[model samples]
Target: MPGEYGYPNLNDNDWIWGGTLTDIETTLTHGIRWEGSDATRVNYMPAFDGMFDAGQVAALTSHVLSLSGKAKPNATGAVLFTENCAACHGATGAGLPAMGAPALNDAIWLYGGSEAAVRKQILAPRHGVMPGWKDRLDPATIKMLAAYVHSRGGGQQAAPAAEPATDVAQAPMAETDG
Candidate 1:
């Protein structure tokens, strides 16, 4: 809402990933689609323009909207969803954390959640990317930021103590500059 690629508010319980401190910490260390870290997370929802016809996409949008009870469930959409979306969004539309799919049943949307918006997303999905903070902040600082995020009340239980941020090893230097 803040910008073209702005992230959602942190205070909400709707986490793309899980809400655990470790989970948030992991996300912070290696952002979504971030190329900076070896452990960086990435999930891509391919556009459906080539995959489905316009009518199918509209029907799929109808089904997705129906997951939240916003629209009547059309057989066409439901069938498409069952065959396609259910794997990641789940049979009940409860999104999978591992797959980075947001729950469609929930009204909370990172992007606009209108029917048209849904259809557009089906046609050309948005692969939201979150930048990693490892290069910008030290491990301890990252943990502190995590703690602050935890204080926002959406945070889950903390995981066991683990090392932070410095997952990748330095690349070997090549003798080039003379």
Candidate 2:
């Protein structure tokens, strides 16, 4: 009979004694004589267990290096937008505020000023509600709508001029409604 360990079972009489000779021999040879039994157990050696190989490590290192400082987009303005922005902001960037879209052309920015900030906004889509213009307007109407918006300066603009220090110091107070 085959033992659970797959070694053939040997009767005691098969060896020098009547006891199960294979088990006795194994116990004596490994457990007692040389302590080879514990060493032969698969779980005893962790190095043999495969996890991350050399190629995988190298690939991971290369990926990390590649991502370092190379993620900034080269595309900007309409080109940057049409390829990336228009889907949410509308072709003209009029913004679908009802869809949480803020008009990009307007001076108002929910986040803040700076190209970096705008880039962040472009990378992450904001969720909001808006009436589906598709349902309300036909394709030709939508096209005309986009054309009208584009005519009204639909792209990004140059950086705003800096305010003179004196102007900044004497800036008028904004009116407040009571």
Candidate 3:
């Protein structure tokens, strides 16, 4: 009777209901009646069990490897960052904590360091809540923002990539005393 709750087959006492219940009764035998009709009627399958094929696994692994190193700056990416992200995240991707910005250079990611994770973050910024600490602590006792940012395990400063030679004018040099 419990299985009659909103189940179309059970509502109409259809053949499917009788067949399924019979099958379950035969399989579970003595336990079926006391266990309730719902128990015997449920058909469960995991959301992701064996979802990915071998090709998908290989592609995902390769994508992860690609994001581990410094991201190659394409002109479009550079322009997009400058216009949208440079104000908060520095031009070099160093995060500014005053604005609650997080460093993109680091391998240590709060949510996840995967390429997919990064893409999701860019698509939707995280909005976390914290209690007001201004009334609880003195300004001098507040922790250094830079140190906190560094403790998050930011990536090492990567050297600039070499560029192909192009025509350039030589600048007049001013000698400086040591």
For each candidate, the alpha-carbon lDDT, in order, equals 0.74, 0.32, 0.35
lDDT-wise, the better of 1 and 3 is 1
lDDT of 1 at 141: 92
Candidate 1 TM-score to native: 0.83
lDDT of 3 at 25: 29
lDDT of 3: 0.35
Q: Please, what are the lDDT tens digits per residue for candidate 2 over residues 80-143?
A: 3443334434454454321223345443444543444443333442322112344445656665
Winning candidate number (TM-score): 1
Q: Rank the candidates by lDDT, best first.
A: 1, 3, 2
Per-residue lDDT value at 128 in model 3: 32
Against the hidden reference, what TM-scores do the models get?
Answer: 0.83, 0.26, 0.37
- Clash counts per candidate, in order, are 0, 4, 0
